[model samples]
Target: MLSPKLEVVITPNRIAVRNVGSGATATADAPFSCSHLLADDIDILEHAAQGAMKQVVGGGFLPSYPIVEVSTGGRPLHQVERKVIRDALANAGASKVHFAPSVTDVDEQADARAAYIAAAKRRR
Candidate 1:
């Protein structure tokens, strides 16, 4: 989980996240999903949160490993969601990125995300 210093907000159509101390920010917008399973706002928010975390982690800092892996609810992201995530990453200066094809355990994923956020903040 993110530390108390991190903040995440979700709305009907968008989500925003940031590290409170470092001023590093990330955001993702809701895009239409083809499958009902991925239609919830929470799903979109999850996608956005992943994007935000990638930004905080400076995915664009090094071109050698430009493809950051995003999570997609343990399955492949829908075509639309994939495009949205890819576009967001590109806008953040991550020239090339892809989503993880498999899911990480829940607690483990949370811990990993927190670590990434913390590490990114430290760099600032």
Candidate 2:
């Protein structure tokens, strides 16, 4: 085996689930997921998510985030949800992950603003 250009966006965990009939059930959990990008790929994760959604969902696509917030790690989604997620990721640009709370701050805000401006200007 060899290391590739893939990125690991998730770590495995053990969690408990409640069944309608059974009281509780413990099972292995994976709260995070990653996209494998081809070599020298930028925004590989987004592309991976896009492709995954299309492959996973077929046509329909939804998202885990609310109508406003941009995120893939939210409540569970059905198969159709994946396509929505795919389009969302594809439509999302640098602004998507950069807007994260962990990355949000005065400096980050300035940077984001600058980026948005540049993108907007470029579009015109």
Candidate 3:
């Protein structure tokens, strides 16, 4: 069976996570601004992402690493900023990470994931 798929949305002050397979969702709010570019501290963003991941995954017996798709709310990230986000998701147990275009609705995110999966299969 394929591992679970996860979607993450990063905003300036909140991290939203959803399990695409299970429909479980979680939201983590940062005490301070969590923006990678505007915030004085970047760790807040990482921490919030970690927290949200944990909330979504819960205590289930995960068979494999979950695939993660992240959206930065339409903001473009620098290479370093992207690395930081990817590292945070990896730390939270994601095996493969993908960045999606700015998506807000759940259906839009799912469509993006489907397109990515299809493209990946073609490349293989």
Candidate 4:
């Protein structure tokens, strides 16, 4: 049996936030499924996680790569996977920049949301 590791993942959406009332540093994590899953180190599946000191406004677990099945038989899917991946990203409050069909280049996409927030904090 050949189990083709099917999955979708990106960079963790880390946005440190301070508790509204307690002023506590809380790190909000996305769902475990959203994290990277790799059958092989050399060839790893896409995944993402976010770290924060406080609860983020609206960022939360948005299911991506809904399922990873082991496929022994193989035909192929050319572009549809991209659409599913795009939808996942959108659900997570991320921009669909890398979800394009033509971008065949297999690179990871991550929003440095934490850095942006940090920068804004500095400016303030």
**Worst 10-residue stretch by lDDT in candidate 3?**
32-41
TM-score of each: 0.35, 0.22, 0.66, 0.23
Q: Which stretches of candidate 3 lie over 4 Å from their true place?
A: 31-43, 60-63, 101-124
- How much is 42 displaced in model 2, in angstroms? 2.9
Residues 61-116 of candidate 4: C-alpha lDDT, one tens digit per residue: 42221222111112122243444434433343333324323234323322475677
Tens-digit lDDT track of model 1 for 54-116: 565455342322334455534434455456555654454344455454632234366888999
Looking at model 3, residue 112 earns an lDDT score of: 87
What tens digits encode model 2's per-residue C-alpha lDDT throughout 28-101? 23322333211122244345434432332233443322112222222333333334333434352211221223
Clashing pairs in 4: 9-46, 9-47, 12-49, 25-53, 26-53, 26-54, 27-52
Ranking by lDDT: 3, 1, 2, 4
Q: Superpose all Cα atoms of candidate 3 onto the true structure and report the RMSD in Å to 1 decimal.
A: 10.6
Q: Give the TM-score of candidate 1.
A: 0.35
Best by lDDT: 3
TM-score of model 4 (CA atoms): 0.23
